[model samples]
Target: MTKSRIRAAKPDTQPHFDYFYDKPGSLPGTLNIGVDAQPPVIVLIDYNEADATRQTLATPEECLPYLDTESVSWVDVQGLGSEDILQRLGQVFNLHPLVLEDIVNVPQRPKVEDDYEDHLVMIARMVIPKESGGFHSEQVSFILGKHYLLTVQEEPEHDCFEQVRQRIRYNKGSVRKLGADYLAYTLIDSIIDGFFPVLEAYGEQMEDLEDEVITKPTRQTLNKIYRVRRELLNLRRAIWPQRDAIAMLIRDDNDSLISDRVQVYLRDCYDHAVQILDMVETYRELTSGLMDVYLSAVSNKMNEIMKLLTVVSSIFIPLTFIAGVYGMNFNTEKSPWNMPELNWYWGYPLCLAAMAATAAGLIYFFWRRGWFENFSDVQDRTSRKRG
Candidate 1:
């Protein structure tokens, strides 16, 4: 059974998703796709206000018939490592040479570009649910033409476009009435929304770390806080560039594909991107402050310990010296002063009283100077249970 499960388990090793490339300075449109990809599977959804048709396309050429029709076509290609299939898809869509290059670049920076063709190429990043419920990011290249959107996702298994697909299948929204740009907006909006739950989880994790850092900080707490800060930094890096890209989509004058109505929707998506960026920035600042607080609390704890040691030494060092002085053996028999005190009946009691009085006086002095209060304050805060 163990062997069977091991064989069935998903591989943890990440394979390289290299960009389809040519030797340096080679001409564009050179296809260097991977041999390991399954034959490209194209799912085409064509919709207009009156009717819609969805079909599993056998080849890239099959999409040709739908592209020229009066409907908005969305052709989603899951994997792009296949060279011959990608080349044919490029031709069937009549994609520009640079456009194909942009699409095949596995991890292009999120951007929007216009080349005076009847299209706009956008590189967007999509983060989807991982098998472990955490998320991983992938680049999605979009070729938004006059009437169709050709979206290529870097990975097959993790995607949040299923809802958009479902909406297309069920005609749940005004998707049928809008153009391909609107459809692109829907998918991008979904991808942006997908980031929220992940961030909410991070926020809660940071809050928990805050409590841990304050109450009983350990080396592990420091490590964990630092890790959270690092992760937040990564998140900030991801979302910051995305915010500018989405803002360009909403504000830039790309007259070819995105419509005015669609730009409004894009504005909403941009708002979300901005909100995500804001949260990331806020979290980053909080994490930085948490580090400071953690260090200060640790230092304060050390200071309290040092104060206690000082107090103990201050109170006992002189007392120990006094005891040592009295413990000395004098020639009492030879000297009348030394022998007279020893012969007194109350000498031992008087010495004991003097020691007690000295201890009491020193303690009273400490209490009057508020040293004891400072010590007790540290003890109380450290010991008190905070809800």
Candidate 2:
């Protein structure tokens, strides 16, 4: 499979569903195709209760024969880089202009729409956990009709639908026996379940962060927390609206495209969406708390350092005073009262002994008060933890 490094078409990002960048007062249904998009790869899977068939189609028109047949047709289009193929595919499927625009604009919010009367249009985000770390996310657009389900994705590389494909190919279950709506639910359920591994990765990272933040937090630790928080926010943004969309799919009685049986399956999908949202929110809160803990740990470290410096300074105060008094020039031979000990043979040794004794006493006093114990305890605890 070929991969494309798709670039952002607009410098500013679209923050939500209601806000987007486009020419002011321009046509509503205009497509914003990315220049670096890959050419589309279309796959068709047509199945009935007896058997199923899967093939790659060279053109959008090639699947026209199966669209109106008794078998359920699933046309999977991966990549939106080629404008001609996308436009032609829209034409072949009888897609509305706005629906086509939503499919191609890349990064529309997850939503469900049945306004077109013949198609149930849904937009969803799929995330795949990277092997190194973090995740990759993309937009998946679905157009469900009477006898067919058409899916358009942003790229070919970041898909998690191989399991669903395998199930249909091997006749492992009832997918071959179901209609297009059930097929749509299977794919949607796959998308919902995909978030778990990504969340699991984040959960493991959060556990590691908890240890690092408490024991050995540096500026780098803070940066990691912020990064995790930002990504979790992305997960939240991608997932929270999905719960709403799935709920709409389950409760949307007016959309005749979704069967009653499919809605029952969709209820389970909705619960998974809620569970994923809860996990995202929980991770976000943990990351935030980690930030606060980091600040407190750093501050406490600083206080310990300041206290050590204070104890050292206190010990030196008296020694400095003793040195200062003897260093003052005194005419010992001219006056009897001017430090007579300067004439003694042991005066030098005596002065040194007094300075050492003073420092020792002060240190002993501080140690007895437990000021020095925490430093040693901290070192011991750190060493033990590291070991």
Candidate 3:
């Protein structure tokens, strides 16, 4: 099946949770889909030890024949755009009204539900790395039954399950021989593993941001830092509950839907969830540190500029005083004390020499105090500004 059946989310890496809120007084089990949503694509894969088959079905009713079979059946629905199609799938799977509501709802948080006797439902957030420096995320709902697993996704594109699909098609592992519980575990593990590559990209972006925060922080740098923090918060919100959901799966051994063997595998999947949460937390802290560093850098740069300007102003103070005293216009003819040097031919030259000497002395004093050396940052900024 082509992975391009779903549309790409917006190019930005923002929270991908599809929030579903009904009218305040709306009845329960109401299905609300985005008007722009595309009709869902249904694909069925039925397999036993000896045979395996894969086909795209036109409608959800076509999945009924395989759902009751002894062999493992995987019904994959790729979109939640069509309310009629979703309602049909719910009926075909004998889904509870609330379960149908949760499934159709874009995002109902990351949790695992086993209230229904026939199936175990797992709601998770899956992320796909985008080529343009961010990630695309969506909701993946898993309904695992005795002999079949029904998987529904928010969108059909940017799929992270191609490897699992390949493994199932080629029988690379025991996924074919195992029950739907194992298939659920495999796909769950794949979904959790999908977070690693996305986290790696975040790690790289944060490293670049660390340098940018210190070297030369700009408004754009601040914006990027804010985005990284917001996105990481979204990631934390996603993976935090997911860890509890996975834990619930492992702890709820009474639910006969999931085999003990698969639960063991789920333990490892839970570990991955915990690991992803740690990464999100670590990145969040790093982004916060980047903000602090940006502020300090800007403040420090401003201080350097103020220091340079102070030194320049200090050097001119004495020269201004000398000129001010000479311009007082005292009449030398009235008294000797008025201005003894005013009639001298060398007075103008002496005054100019005095001003030049005063400036040089102030400059030397500031340089001796190491104030001039501190202006290196200011000098660099000035040079760049000129350039």
- Most TM-score-accurate candidate: 3
Computed on alpha carbons, the lDDT of every model, listed in order, comes to 0.76, 0.86, 0.84
Q: Candidate 1: where are CA atoms >4 Å away? A: 1-40, 129-134, 311-387
TM-score of each: 0.74, 0.81, 0.82
Best by lDDT: 2
Tens-digit lDDT track of model 2 for 1-387: 111223335533322232234555767777777777888999999988888898999999998999889899999999988888998999999998888988988777899987787788999999998897878888999999888999998988999999999998898777888889899999999999999999999999999999999999999999899878877887888988889998888876635878788898999999899899889988999999999999999999999999899889977977789779778768888998988888889988998888789778988998899877877788999999999
lDDT, candidate 2, at 222? 97
After superposing candidate 3 on the true structure, give the runs of residues whose Cα lies further than 4 Å from its correct spot: 1-18, 330-387
How does residue 33 of candidate 3 score in lDDT? Answer: 78
lDDT of 2: 0.86
Q: Give the better candidate number (2 or 3) by lDDT.
A: 2
Q: What C-alpha lDDT, on a 0 to 100 scale, does residue 256 get in candidate 2?
A: 80
Model 2 alpha-carbon miss at residue 364, Å: 18
Q: Return the candidate ranking by TM-score, descending.
A: 3, 2, 1
Where in model 2 is the C-alpha error above 4 Å?
1-20, 325-387
Residue 244, model 1, lDDT: 81
By summed lDDT, the worst window of 10 consecutive residues in model 1 runs over 1-10
Per-residue CA lDDT of candidate 3, range 1-387, in tens? 111122227545454343556665678888877766668999999998788999999988899899889999999999888888999899999999888888877667888887788888889888888787667778899999999999998888868889988988888889988899999989889888988988999999998998888777899999999888877887788788889989988876535888888888999999889989988998988888888899999999999999899889977977788778778888888899988888889988998898789778988997998876757788999999999
